[model samples]
Target: MGTQFWVKGTVLCKTGAQVVNATGPELDKFIGKISYGLFHGQRLKQCGLGGRPFRFSFFPSLMEVIPASLHISVIFFCSVLIVFSSVASAFFMYNAFGSPYETLHGPLGLYLWNFICCSCSCLVMILFASEVKFHRLSEKIANYNESTFVYKTYTERFDRSFWIILFTFLSHTLNILLIRLAGIQFPFQEAKEATVNTGASDLMY
Candidate 1:
Protein backbone atom coordinates (compact mmCIF):
# COMPACT_ATOMS: atom_id res chain seq x y z
CA MET A 1 0.00 0.00 0.00
CA GLY A 2 1.17 3.60 -0.70
CA THR A 3 0.26 7.17 -1.68
CA GLN A 4 0.43 9.55 -4.64
CA PHE A 5 1.18 13.27 -4.72
CA TRP A 6 0.41 15.94 -7.27
CA VAL A 7 3.59 16.94 -9.10
CA LYS A 8 2.55 20.59 -9.19
CA GLY A 9 0.19 22.94 -7.44
CA THR A 10 -3.42 22.81 -8.71
CA VAL A 11 -4.63 26.33 -8.12
CA LEU A 12 -3.72 29.41 -10.15
CA CYS A 13 -4.51 33.03 -9.22
CA LYS A 14 -5.50 35.62 -11.80
CA THR A 15 -3.74 38.99 -12.26
CA GLY A 16 -6.16 40.55 -9.71
CA ALA A 17 -5.08 37.74 -7.27
CA GLN A 18 -8.71 37.11 -6.33
CA VAL A 19 -9.98 34.64 -8.93
CA VAL A 20 -8.44 31.13 -8.87
CA ASN A 21 -8.72 28.50 -11.59
CA ALA A 22 -7.16 25.35 -13.02
CA THR A 23 -7.39 24.34 -16.69
CA GLY A 24 -5.77 22.25 -19.46
CA PRO A 25 -3.17 19.63 -18.32
CA GLU A 26 -3.37 20.93 -14.74
CA LEU A 27 -6.92 19.71 -14.48
CA ASP A 28 -5.93 16.14 -15.45
CA LYS A 29 -2.37 16.22 -14.10
CA PHE A 30 -2.99 13.79 -11.30
CA ILE A 31 -5.03 11.43 -13.46
CA GLY A 32 -3.61 7.88 -13.64
CA LYS A 33 -0.22 9.19 -12.54
CA ILE A 34 1.30 7.61 -9.47
CA SER A 35 4.14 9.48 -7.81
CA TYR A 36 5.38 6.25 -6.33
CA GLY A 37 4.13 2.83 -5.24
CA LEU A 38 5.00 0.69 -2.24
CA PHE A 39 3.86 -2.75 -3.28
CA HIS A 40 4.04 -6.16 -1.70
CA GLY A 41 7.19 -8.10 -2.78
CA GLN A 42 7.36 -6.09 -6.03
CA ARG A 43 9.71 -3.15 -6.51
CA LEU A 44 8.74 0.28 -5.29
CA LYS A 45 8.27 1.88 -8.69
CA GLN A 46 8.12 5.55 -9.55
CA CYS A 47 5.83 7.00 -12.21
CA GLY A 48 4.25 10.35 -12.94
CA LEU A 49 4.70 13.78 -14.55
CA GLY A 50 8.48 14.26 -14.24
CA GLY A 51 11.77 12.49 -13.65
CA ARG A 52 12.86 9.05 -14.87
CA PRO A 53 10.82 6.16 -13.46
CA PHE A 54 12.83 3.75 -11.35
CA ARG A 55 12.43 0.77 -9.03
CA PHE A 56 13.78 -0.33 -5.68
CA SER A 57 13.19 -2.82 -2.86
CA PHE A 58 12.01 -2.15 0.70
CA PHE A 59 14.29 -4.78 2.23
CA PRO A 60 17.93 -3.88 3.12
CA SER A 61 17.47 -0.50 1.46
CA LEU A 62 14.73 1.03 3.60
CA MET A 63 14.75 -1.65 6.27
CA GLU A 64 16.09 0.47 9.07
CA VAL A 65 13.76 3.36 8.33
CA ILE A 66 10.54 1.27 8.23
CA PRO A 67 8.98 -0.42 11.24
CA ALA A 68 10.67 -3.78 11.06
CA SER A 69 8.76 -5.54 13.85
CA LEU A 70 5.30 -4.60 12.65
CA HIS A 71 6.16 -5.22 9.02
CA ILE A 72 7.55 -8.64 9.89
CA SER A 73 4.47 -9.42 11.94
CA VAL A 74 2.25 -8.59 9.00
CA ILE A 75 4.28 -10.82 6.74
CA PHE A 76 4.21 -13.59 9.33
CA PHE A 77 0.42 -13.47 9.59
CA CYS A 78 0.07 -13.47 5.83
CA SER A 79 2.19 -16.58 5.69
CA VAL A 80 0.00 -18.12 8.35
CA LEU A 81 -3.04 -17.23 6.28
CA ILE A 82 -1.59 -18.97 3.27
CA VAL A 83 -0.69 -22.10 5.22
CA PHE A 84 -4.08 -22.38 6.86
CA SER A 85 -5.88 -21.74 3.61
CA SER A 86 -4.06 -24.68 2.10
CA VAL A 87 -4.83 -26.78 5.16
CA ALA A 88 -8.48 -25.90 4.80
CA SER A 89 -8.42 -26.84 1.16
CA ALA A 90 -6.90 -30.20 1.97
CA PHE A 91 -9.49 -30.82 4.65
CA PHE A 92 -12.24 -29.93 2.22
CA MET A 93 -10.89 -32.46 -0.23
CA TYR A 94 -10.70 -35.09 2.47
CA ASN A 95 -14.23 -34.45 3.57
CA ALA A 96 -15.45 -34.76 0.02
CA PHE A 97 -13.48 -37.87 -0.99
CA GLY A 98 -13.06 -39.97 2.13
CA SER A 99 -14.74 -41.06 5.33
CA PRO A 100 -13.70 -38.44 7.86
CA TYR A 101 -13.83 -38.54 11.63
CA GLU A 102 -16.42 -36.54 13.57
CA THR A 103 -14.52 -33.86 15.45
CA LEU A 104 -11.31 -32.58 13.85
CA HIS A 105 -11.62 -34.32 10.46
CA GLY A 106 -15.23 -33.55 9.62
CA PRO A 107 -17.21 -30.38 8.98
CA LEU A 108 -15.99 -29.04 12.29
CA GLY A 109 -12.42 -29.19 11.01
CA LEU A 110 -13.31 -27.13 7.96
CA TYR A 111 -14.90 -24.50 10.16
CA LEU A 112 -11.87 -24.47 12.44
CA TRP A 113 -9.39 -23.99 9.59
CA ASN A 114 -11.50 -21.33 7.93
CA PHE A 115 -11.85 -19.48 11.22
CA ILE A 116 -8.08 -19.64 11.71
CA CYS A 117 -7.51 -18.18 8.25
CA CYS A 118 -10.01 -15.42 9.01
CA SER A 119 -8.17 -14.57 12.21
CA CYS A 120 -4.86 -14.50 10.36
CA SER A 121 -6.32 -12.30 7.64
CA CYS A 122 -7.63 -9.87 10.26
CA LEU A 123 -4.27 -9.81 12.03
CA VAL A 124 -2.46 -9.12 8.75
CA MET A 125 -4.69 -6.15 8.01
CA ILE A 126 -4.44 -4.71 11.52
CA LEU A 127 -0.67 -5.07 11.73
CA PHE A 128 -0.06 -3.69 8.23
CA ALA A 129 -2.45 -0.79 8.78
CA SER A 130 -0.88 0.02 12.15
CA GLU A 131 2.56 -0.06 10.54
CA VAL A 132 1.40 2.20 7.75
CA LYS A 133 -0.85 4.75 9.48
CA PHE A 134 0.53 4.92 13.01
CA HIS A 135 4.12 4.59 11.83
CA ARG A 136 3.79 7.20 9.01
CA LEU A 137 5.03 4.71 6.44
CA SER A 138 4.50 6.75 3.28
CA GLU A 139 6.28 9.82 4.62
CA LYS A 140 9.13 7.67 5.86
CA ILE A 141 9.50 6.06 2.44
CA ALA A 142 9.25 9.39 0.60
CA ASN A 143 11.85 11.06 2.81
CA TYR A 144 14.23 8.16 3.24
CA ASN A 145 17.88 9.31 3.14
CA GLU A 146 17.00 12.43 1.22
CA SER A 147 18.94 15.63 1.85
CA THR A 148 16.60 17.55 -0.39
CA PHE A 149 13.30 19.18 0.62
CA VAL A 150 11.20 17.13 3.02
CA TYR A 151 8.30 15.29 1.44
CA LYS A 152 4.86 15.66 2.98
CA THR A 153 1.99 13.33 2.26
CA TYR A 154 -0.28 14.96 -0.27
CA THR A 155 -2.42 11.82 -0.48
CA GLU A 156 -2.22 8.47 1.28
CA ARG A 157 -4.38 5.37 1.23
CA PHE A 158 -4.49 1.61 1.46
CA ASP A 159 -3.99 0.09 -1.98
CA ARG A 160 -5.56 -2.94 -3.69
CA SER A 161 -3.33 -5.41 -1.93
CA PHE A 162 -4.72 -4.27 1.40
CA TRP A 163 -8.26 -4.54 0.05
CA ILE A 164 -7.54 -7.99 -1.28
CA ILE A 165 -6.66 -9.16 2.22
CA LEU A 166 -9.82 -7.58 3.49
CA PHE A 167 -11.80 -9.48 0.90
CA THR A 168 -10.01 -12.63 1.92
CA PHE A 169 -11.16 -12.09 5.48
CA LEU A 170 -14.70 -11.64 4.27
CA SER A 171 -14.50 -14.73 2.12
CA HIS A 172 -13.43 -16.79 5.12
CA THR A 173 -16.27 -15.42 7.18
CA LEU A 174 -18.72 -16.21 4.42
CA ASN A 175 -17.32 -19.68 4.17
CA ILE A 176 -18.07 -20.17 7.88
CA LEU A 177 -21.62 -18.97 7.35
CA LEU A 178 -22.08 -21.23 4.35
CA ILE A 179 -20.86 -24.18 6.40
CA ARG A 180 -23.46 -23.40 9.04
CA LEU A 181 -26.15 -22.95 6.41
CA ALA A 182 -25.28 -26.34 4.94
CA GLY A 183 -26.98 -27.80 8.06
CA ILE A 184 -23.81 -28.82 9.88
CA GLN A 185 -24.39 -27.99 13.52
CA PHE A 186 -21.55 -26.54 15.54
CA PRO A 187 -19.58 -29.21 17.40
CA PHE A 188 -20.47 -27.91 20.86
CA GLN A 189 -24.10 -27.37 19.91
CA GLU A 190 -24.37 -30.95 18.62
CA ALA A 191 -22.85 -32.24 21.86
CA LYS A 192 -25.20 -30.19 24.03
CA GLU A 193 -28.27 -31.31 22.09
CA ALA A 194 -27.14 -34.96 22.31
CA THR A 195 -26.74 -34.57 26.08
CA VAL A 196 -30.22 -33.06 26.40
CA ASN A 197 -31.80 -35.84 24.33
CA THR A 198 -30.09 -38.50 26.42
CA GLY A 199 -31.35 -36.89 29.64
CA ALA A 200 -34.90 -36.77 28.29
CA SER A 201 -34.75 -40.43 27.26
CA ASP A 202 -33.50 -41.44 30.74
CA LEU A 203 -36.41 -39.54 32.37
CA MET A 204 -38.97 -41.26 30.08
CA TYR A 205 -37.49 -44.72 30.89
Candidate 2:
Protein backbone atom coordinates (compact mmCIF):
# COMPACT_ATOMS: atom_id res chain seq x y z
CA MET A 1 0.00 0.00 0.00
CA GLY A 2 1.09 3.55 -0.71
CA THR A 3 1.93 5.82 2.20
CA GLN A 4 -1.47 6.60 3.79
CA PHE A 5 -2.16 8.30 7.14
CA TRP A 6 -5.42 7.95 9.11
CA VAL A 7 -6.24 9.99 12.22
CA LYS A 8 -9.02 9.05 14.77
CA GLY A 9 -9.58 10.96 17.98
CA THR A 10 -12.28 10.97 20.79
CA VAL A 11 -13.42 14.35 22.21
CA LEU A 12 -15.00 14.78 25.71
CA CYS A 13 -17.33 17.80 26.35
CA LYS A 14 -18.45 19.21 29.77
CA THR A 15 -21.55 21.44 30.36
CA GLY A 16 -21.72 23.91 33.28
CA ALA A 17 -24.56 26.16 34.58
CA GLN A 18 -24.05 29.79 35.71
CA VAL A 19 -26.16 31.61 38.37
CA VAL A 20 -26.89 35.36 38.24
CA ASN A 21 -28.28 37.33 41.18
CA ALA A 22 -30.70 40.28 40.57
CA THR A 23 -30.61 42.18 43.90
CA GLY A 24 -30.36 45.97 43.75
CA PRO A 25 -32.12 49.23 44.60
CA GLU A 26 -33.19 49.72 40.95
CA LEU A 27 -35.03 46.38 40.83
CA ASP A 28 -36.71 47.07 44.19
CA LYS A 29 -37.85 50.52 42.98
CA PHE A 30 -39.26 49.01 39.77
CA ILE A 31 -41.25 46.40 41.73
CA GLY A 32 -42.59 49.06 44.11
CA LYS A 33 -43.96 51.17 41.23
CA ILE A 34 -45.79 48.22 39.60
CA SER A 35 -49.51 48.22 40.55
CA TYR A 36 -53.02 47.67 39.18
CA GLY A 37 -55.96 50.11 39.31
CA LEU A 38 -59.27 51.03 37.68
CA PHE A 39 -57.72 54.46 37.35
CA HIS A 40 -54.08 55.47 37.57
CA GLY A 41 -52.72 55.40 41.13
CA GLN A 42 -56.01 53.96 42.40
CA ARG A 43 -54.40 50.62 43.16
CA LEU A 44 -56.83 47.80 43.91
CA LYS A 45 -55.35 45.39 46.46
CA GLN A 46 -57.44 42.26 46.65
CA CYS A 47 -56.85 38.51 46.91
CA GLY A 48 -53.19 39.11 47.87
CA LEU A 49 -52.30 40.13 44.34
CA GLY A 50 -51.61 43.79 43.43
CA GLY A 51 -49.06 44.61 40.73
CA ARG A 52 -48.34 45.16 37.05
CA PRO A 53 -48.97 41.48 36.27
CA PHE A 54 -52.63 41.68 37.26
CA ARG A 55 -54.21 38.40 38.23
CA PHE A 56 -57.85 38.24 37.22
CA SER A 57 -60.49 35.52 37.29
CA PHE A 58 -63.70 35.63 35.26
CA PHE A 59 -65.66 33.95 37.99
CA PRO A 60 -63.90 34.59 41.28
CA SER A 61 -66.88 33.23 43.21
CA LEU A 62 -69.82 31.00 42.32
CA MET A 63 -72.39 33.55 43.53
CA GLU A 64 -71.30 36.18 40.98
CA VAL A 65 -72.83 34.24 38.05
CA ILE A 66 -76.61 34.41 37.77
CA PRO A 67 -79.16 33.39 35.12
CA ALA A 68 -79.80 36.10 32.51
CA SER A 69 -83.57 35.99 33.11
CA LEU A 70 -83.15 36.39 36.85
CA HIS A 71 -80.75 39.26 36.28
CA ILE A 72 -83.27 40.99 34.01
CA SER A 73 -86.04 40.48 36.55
CA VAL A 74 -83.88 41.97 39.32
CA ILE A 75 -83.11 44.99 37.16
CA PHE A 76 -86.81 45.42 36.36
CA PHE A 77 -87.69 45.24 40.04
CA CYS A 78 -85.10 47.85 40.89
CA SER A 79 -86.36 50.09 38.09
CA VAL A 80 -89.94 49.79 39.39
CA LEU A 81 -88.75 50.59 42.90
CA ILE A 82 -86.85 53.70 41.77
CA VAL A 83 -89.80 54.87 39.65
CA PHE A 84 -92.44 54.31 42.33
CA SER A 85 -90.30 55.95 45.00
CA SER A 86 -89.58 58.94 42.76
CA VAL A 87 -93.25 59.37 41.84
CA ALA A 88 -94.44 59.06 45.44
CA SER A 89 -91.81 61.49 46.64
CA ALA A 90 -92.70 64.04 43.97
CA PHE A 91 -96.45 63.71 44.60
CA PHE A 92 -96.00 64.18 48.37
CA MET A 93 -93.72 67.18 47.93
CA TYR A 94 -96.07 68.87 45.42
CA ASN A 95 -98.97 68.49 47.84
CA ALA A 96 -96.88 69.18 50.95
CA PHE A 97 -98.93 72.16 52.04
CA GLY A 98 -102.20 71.36 50.23
CA SER A 99 -103.44 68.46 52.35
CA PRO A 100 -102.44 67.64 55.93
CA TYR A 101 -104.62 64.53 56.08
CA GLU A 102 -103.28 63.05 52.87
CA THR A 103 -99.66 63.70 53.78
CA LEU A 104 -98.43 62.14 57.02
CA HIS A 105 -97.80 64.94 59.58
CA GLY A 106 -94.63 63.91 61.45
CA PRO A 107 -93.05 62.44 58.30
CA LEU A 108 -93.72 65.59 56.23
CA GLY A 109 -90.07 66.54 56.70
CA LEU A 110 -89.12 63.00 55.76
CA TYR A 111 -91.21 63.25 52.58
CA LEU A 112 -89.61 66.55 51.66
CA TRP A 113 -86.18 65.00 52.12
CA ASN A 114 -87.29 61.95 50.14
CA PHE A 115 -88.59 64.25 47.41
CA ILE A 116 -85.31 66.05 47.12
CA CYS A 117 -83.41 62.78 47.14
CA CYS A 118 -85.67 61.00 44.62
CA SER A 119 -85.77 64.03 42.34
CA CYS A 120 -81.98 64.14 42.35
CA SER A 121 -81.86 60.36 41.76
CA CYS A 122 -84.24 60.57 38.79
CA LEU A 123 -82.33 63.50 37.34
CA VAL A 124 -79.04 61.63 37.63
CA MET A 125 -80.50 58.49 36.04
CA ILE A 126 -82.02 60.52 33.19
CA LEU A 127 -78.77 62.35 32.61
CA PHE A 128 -76.80 59.10 32.51
CA ALA A 129 -79.28 57.46 30.13
CA SER A 130 -79.28 60.51 27.88
CA GLU A 131 -75.52 60.59 27.84
CA VAL A 132 -75.33 56.96 26.78
CA LYS A 133 -77.96 57.38 24.03
CA PHE A 134 -77.30 60.93 22.81
CA HIS A 135 -73.55 61.27 23.21
CA ARG A 136 -72.84 59.46 19.93
CA LEU A 137 -75.57 61.40 18.18
CA SER A 138 -74.09 64.69 19.39
CA GLU A 139 -70.66 63.59 18.28
CA LYS A 140 -71.97 63.01 14.74
CA ILE A 141 -73.44 66.55 14.64
CA ALA A 142 -71.38 69.29 12.95
CA ASN A 143 -72.17 72.05 15.46
CA TYR A 144 -71.07 70.01 18.50
CA ASN A 145 -67.73 69.15 16.89
CA GLU A 146 -66.66 72.79 16.55
CA SER A 147 -63.48 73.70 18.47
CA THR A 148 -64.62 77.24 19.36
CA PHE A 149 -67.45 76.26 21.74
CA VAL A 150 -67.35 78.66 24.71
CA TYR A 151 -69.12 76.80 27.50
CA LYS A 152 -68.53 73.18 28.49
CA THR A 153 -71.50 70.86 27.91
CA TYR A 154 -72.98 68.36 30.38
CA THR A 155 -71.98 65.45 28.14
CA GLU A 156 -68.31 66.43 28.33
CA ARG A 157 -68.17 66.23 32.11
CA PHE A 158 -68.90 63.47 34.65
CA ASP A 159 -70.95 64.97 37.44
CA ARG A 160 -70.14 63.80 40.97
CA SER A 161 -73.83 64.44 41.71
CA PHE A 162 -74.62 61.20 39.88
CA TRP A 163 -72.81 59.16 42.52
CA ILE A 164 -74.51 61.11 45.27
CA ILE A 165 -77.94 60.39 43.82
CA LEU A 166 -77.08 56.73 43.23
CA PHE A 167 -75.99 56.22 46.83
CA THR A 168 -79.07 58.10 48.08
CA PHE A 169 -81.38 55.91 46.03
CA LEU A 170 -79.63 52.75 47.22
CA SER A 171 -79.92 53.79 50.87
CA HIS A 172 -83.54 54.87 50.41
CA THR A 173 -84.40 51.51 48.88
CA LEU A 174 -82.57 49.69 51.63
CA ASN A 175 -84.48 51.62 54.29
CA ILE A 176 -87.76 50.70 52.67
CA LEU A 177 -86.75 47.04 52.55
CA LEU A 178 -85.64 47.16 56.18
CA ILE A 179 -88.97 48.67 57.25
CA ARG A 180 -90.87 45.94 55.41
CA LEU A 181 -88.63 43.26 56.86
CA ALA A 182 -89.27 44.62 60.36
CA GLY A 183 -93.05 44.42 59.73
CA ILE A 184 -93.49 48.16 60.39
CA GLN A 185 -96.48 49.65 58.57
CA PHE A 186 -96.28 53.12 57.02
CA PRO A 187 -98.12 56.04 58.63
CA PHE A 188 -100.09 56.55 55.43
CA GLN A 189 -101.60 53.06 55.79
CA GLU A 190 -102.76 53.84 59.34
CA ALA A 191 -104.20 57.18 58.18
CA LYS A 192 -106.15 55.51 55.41
CA GLU A 193 -107.57 52.89 57.79
CA ALA A 194 -108.55 55.60 60.31
CA THR A 195 -110.32 57.55 57.58
CA VAL A 196 -112.18 54.43 56.48
CA ASN A 197 -113.30 53.67 60.10
CA THR A 198 -114.43 57.27 60.62
CA GLY A 199 -116.48 57.16 57.41
CA ALA A 200 -118.12 53.88 58.50
CA SER A 201 -118.93 55.32 61.96
CA ASP A 202 -120.44 58.46 60.39
CA LEU A 203 -122.60 56.29 58.09
CA MET A 204 -123.78 54.25 61.07
CA TYR A 205 -124.64 57.42 63.04
Candidate 3:
Protein backbone atom coordinates (compact mmCIF):
# COMPACT_ATOMS: atom_id res chain seq x y z
CA MET A 1 0.00 0.00 0.00
CA GLY A 2 1.19 3.48 -0.81
CA THR A 3 2.02 5.66 2.17
CA GLN A 4 -1.11 7.74 2.28
CA PHE A 5 -1.83 10.45 4.85
CA TRP A 6 -4.49 13.06 5.35
CA VAL A 7 -3.28 16.54 6.25
CA LYS A 8 -5.39 18.11 8.99
CA GLY A 9 -5.75 21.50 10.65
CA THR A 10 -4.87 24.91 9.30
CA VAL A 11 -1.36 25.96 8.36
CA LEU A 12 -0.71 28.12 11.37
CA CYS A 13 2.67 26.92 12.53
CA LYS A 14 3.63 26.30 8.95
CA THR A 15 3.67 30.06 8.43
CA GLY A 16 7.48 30.35 8.61
CA ALA A 17 7.52 28.94 12.15
CA GLN A 18 9.27 25.69 11.24
CA VAL A 19 11.54 27.46 8.76
CA VAL A 20 12.99 29.80 11.37
CA ASN A 21 14.37 27.56 14.09
CA ALA A 22 15.73 29.55 17.02
CA THR A 23 18.89 28.96 19.06
CA GLY A 24 18.89 28.50 22.86
CA PRO A 25 19.46 32.18 23.68
CA GLU A 26 16.99 33.40 21.08
CA LEU A 27 14.34 30.96 22.26
CA ASP A 28 14.82 31.96 25.88
CA LYS A 29 14.38 35.64 25.09
CA PHE A 30 11.32 34.90 22.98
CA ILE A 31 9.73 32.93 25.80
CA GLY A 32 10.45 35.70 28.27
CA LYS A 33 8.54 38.13 26.05
CA ILE A 34 5.30 36.15 26.17
CA SER A 35 3.86 38.66 28.68
CA TYR A 36 1.05 36.94 30.61
CA GLY A 37 -0.09 40.42 31.69
CA LEU A 38 -2.10 38.92 34.54
CA PHE A 39 -0.23 41.51 36.61
CA HIS A 40 1.25 43.84 34.06
CA GLY A 41 0.95 47.62 34.19
CA GLN A 42 -0.14 48.49 30.59
CA ARG A 43 -2.26 45.42 29.86
CA LEU A 44 -5.59 47.18 29.70
CA LYS A 45 -6.60 47.14 26.04
CA GLN A 46 -6.97 43.47 25.10
CA CYS A 47 -6.47 44.54 21.45
CA GLY A 48 -9.58 42.79 20.02
CA LEU A 49 -11.25 40.20 22.20
CA GLY A 50 -14.51 41.94 23.06
CA GLY A 51 -14.48 45.74 23.55
CA ARG A 52 -12.42 48.03 21.41
CA PRO A 53 -11.39 51.56 22.26
CA PHE A 54 -12.54 54.74 20.58
CA ARG A 55 -12.31 58.47 21.17
CA PHE A 56 -15.31 60.44 22.36
CA SER A 57 -13.30 63.50 21.23
CA PHE A 58 -9.73 62.47 22.00
CA PHE A 59 -10.44 63.36 25.60
CA PRO A 60 -7.45 62.70 27.79
CA SER A 61 -8.30 60.52 30.77
CA LEU A 62 -7.73 57.07 32.27
CA MET A 63 -10.02 54.09 31.73
CA GLU A 64 -9.59 50.68 33.28
CA VAL A 65 -11.55 47.94 31.57
CA ILE A 66 -12.06 44.38 32.70
CA PRO A 67 -8.93 42.91 31.19
CA ALA A 68 -11.06 39.84 30.49
CA SER A 69 -13.77 39.23 27.89
CA LEU A 70 -17.35 38.06 28.40
CA HIS A 71 -19.51 35.25 27.03
CA ILE A 72 -23.12 35.50 25.93
CA SER A 73 -24.33 33.53 28.89
CA VAL A 74 -22.56 35.74 31.41
CA ILE A 75 -23.54 38.90 29.62
CA PHE A 76 -27.10 37.68 29.22
CA PHE A 77 -27.30 36.93 32.91
CA CYS A 78 -26.18 40.44 33.72
CA SER A 79 -28.60 41.97 31.26
CA VAL A 80 -31.39 39.80 32.62
CA LEU A 81 -30.45 40.92 36.09
CA ILE A 82 -30.84 44.53 35.05
CA VAL A 83 -34.22 43.76 33.58
CA PHE A 84 -35.22 41.74 36.59
CA SER A 85 -34.31 44.47 39.04
CA SER A 86 -35.97 47.16 37.01
CA VAL A 87 -39.14 45.17 36.67
CA ALA A 88 -39.10 44.29 40.32
CA SER A 89 -38.60 47.93 41.23
CA ALA A 90 -41.46 48.94 39.00
CA PHE A 91 -43.61 46.22 40.48
CA PHE A 92 -42.76 47.48 43.94
CA MET A 93 -43.82 50.96 42.92
CA TYR A 94 -47.05 49.57 41.52
CA ASN A 95 -48.02 47.99 44.82
CA ALA A 96 -47.41 51.24 46.73
CA PHE A 97 -50.93 52.21 45.66
CA GLY A 98 -52.79 50.11 48.24
CA SER A 99 -51.62 46.54 47.82
CA PRO A 100 -49.96 44.43 50.50
CA TYR A 101 -46.80 46.57 50.11
CA GLU A 102 -45.09 43.25 49.58
CA THR A 103 -45.09 43.63 45.80
CA LEU A 104 -41.31 43.92 45.88
CA HIS A 105 -41.43 40.33 47.05
CA GLY A 106 -41.82 38.56 43.70
CA PRO A 107 -39.44 40.64 41.56
CA LEU A 108 -36.94 40.54 44.38
CA GLY A 109 -37.03 36.77 44.38
CA LEU A 110 -36.69 36.60 40.60
CA TYR A 111 -33.77 39.05 40.57
CA LEU A 112 -32.03 37.06 43.28
CA TRP A 113 -32.49 33.84 41.36
CA ASN A 114 -31.20 35.44 38.17
CA PHE A 115 -28.22 36.86 40.00
CA ILE A 116 -27.30 33.50 41.49
CA CYS A 117 -27.76 31.75 38.20
CA CYS A 118 -25.63 34.33 36.39
CA SER A 119 -22.88 34.16 39.00
CA CYS A 120 -22.79 30.37 38.99
CA SER A 121 -22.77 30.30 35.22
CA CYS A 122 -19.89 32.76 35.06
CA LEU A 123 -17.94 30.75 37.62
CA VAL A 124 -18.44 27.60 35.60
CA MET A 125 -17.09 29.31 32.48
CA ILE A 126 -14.03 30.56 34.30
CA LEU A 127 -13.28 27.16 35.86
CA PHE A 128 -13.73 25.45 32.55
CA ALA A 129 -11.53 27.98 30.75
CA SER A 130 -8.88 27.82 33.45
CA GLU A 131 -8.67 24.09 32.85
CA VAL A 132 -8.15 24.64 29.11
CA LYS A 133 -4.67 23.88 27.86
CA PHE A 134 -3.03 27.04 26.55
CA HIS A 135 -0.41 25.07 24.65
CA ARG A 136 2.56 26.12 22.57
CA LEU A 137 3.17 25.72 18.85
CA SER A 138 4.96 22.39 19.40
CA GLU A 139 2.01 20.88 21.23
CA LYS A 140 -0.51 21.66 18.51
CA ILE A 141 1.85 20.19 15.92
CA ALA A 142 2.12 17.04 17.99
CA ASN A 143 -1.62 16.51 17.74
CA TYR A 144 -1.82 17.83 14.20
CA ASN A 145 -3.84 14.86 13.07
CA GLU A 146 -5.61 13.41 16.09
CA SER A 147 -8.89 14.75 14.78
CA THR A 148 -9.99 17.60 12.62
CA PHE A 149 -10.87 19.48 15.77
CA VAL A 150 -9.60 22.99 15.08
CA TYR A 151 -9.90 25.26 18.06
CA LYS A 152 -8.60 28.73 18.86
CA THR A 153 -5.78 29.25 21.33
CA TYR A 154 -6.51 29.21 25.03
CA THR A 155 -6.84 32.95 24.58
CA GLU A 156 -9.02 32.70 21.52
CA ARG A 157 -10.82 29.50 22.57
CA PHE A 158 -12.93 31.23 25.17
CA ASP A 159 -12.69 34.78 23.76
CA ARG A 160 -11.26 36.50 26.83
CA SER A 161 -12.99 34.24 29.35
CA PHE A 162 -10.11 34.73 31.75
CA TRP A 163 -10.35 38.48 31.59
CA ILE A 164 -14.10 38.32 31.77
CA ILE A 165 -13.99 36.38 35.00
CA LEU A 166 -11.30 38.58 36.45
CA PHE A 167 -12.99 41.83 35.54
CA THR A 168 -16.37 40.51 36.60
CA PHE A 169 -14.90 39.60 39.96
CA LEU A 170 -13.25 42.98 40.27
CA SER A 171 -16.43 44.75 39.27
CA HIS A 172 -18.17 43.03 42.13
CA THR A 173 -15.56 43.87 44.76
CA LEU A 174 -14.49 47.33 43.61
CA ASN A 175 -17.62 48.58 41.96
CA ILE A 176 -17.95 51.85 43.83
CA LEU A 177 -14.26 52.58 43.59
CA LEU A 178 -14.30 51.86 39.87
CA ILE A 179 -17.16 54.26 39.28
CA ARG A 180 -15.54 56.89 41.43
CA LEU A 181 -12.11 56.59 39.90
CA ALA A 182 -13.73 56.38 36.50
CA GLY A 183 -10.57 54.71 35.32
CA ILE A 184 -12.70 52.32 33.29
CA GLN A 185 -16.45 52.29 32.75
CA PHE A 186 -18.08 48.88 32.66
CA PRO A 187 -21.78 48.33 33.05
CA PHE A 188 -22.39 46.76 36.45
CA GLN A 189 -25.06 48.92 38.02
CA GLU A 190 -27.57 46.08 38.04
CA ALA A 191 -25.31 43.64 39.84
CA LYS A 192 -23.95 46.29 42.16
CA GLU A 193 -27.31 47.79 43.02
CA ALA A 194 -28.71 44.34 43.46
CA THR A 195 -26.03 43.88 46.07
CA VAL A 196 -27.48 46.66 48.27
CA ASN A 197 -31.11 47.66 47.72
CA THR A 198 -31.21 44.18 46.33
CA GLY A 199 -33.77 43.87 49.07
CA ALA A 200 -36.58 44.39 46.56
CA SER A 201 -36.49 48.03 45.47
CA ASP A 202 -40.14 47.37 44.90
CA LEU A 203 -40.90 48.76 48.34
CA MET A 204 -39.27 51.96 49.68
CA TYR A 205 -38.24 53.84 46.58
Give TM-scores for every candidate, taking all chains together and pairing residue i with residue i.
Answer: 0.68, 0.29, 0.27
**Better model by TM-score, 1 or 2?**
1
In Å, residue 157's CA in model 3 sits off its true spot by: 12
In Å, residue 128's CA in model 2 sits off its true spot by 3.7
For model 1, the stretches where C-alpha displacement exceeds 4 angstroms are: 1-49, 99-107, 192-205
lDDT of 3 by residue, 67-113 (tens): 12332333354455445445544643565564653433233342343
* Candidate 3 minimal-lDDT segment of 10 residues: 1-10
Q: Write candidate 2's Cα lDDT for 75-186 as tens digits.
A: 3434554665665566545545666444433333433345445555565466444532454211222112225321111123323433444677777666555444544345
What is the alpha-carbon lDDT of model 2 when measured against the actual structure?
Answer: 0.34
Q: Where does candidate 2 clash, by residue pair?
A: none
Ranking of models by lDDT: 1, 2, 3
lDDT of 3 at 88: 42
Model 3 stretches with alpha carbons more than 4 Å out: 1-22, 26-114, 133-142, 146-161, 172-205
Off by over 4 Å in 2: 1-108, 135-161, 179-184, 191-205
Model 1 agreement with the true structure over 75-144: per-residue lDDT tens digits: 7887889888877776677565664343232434667788899999999888877876688776666556
Global Cα RMSD, each model: 9.1, 25.4, 17.0
lDDT of 1 at 76: 80
Candidate-wise lDDT, in order: 0.57, 0.34, 0.33
Candidates sorted by TM-score, best first: 1, 2, 3
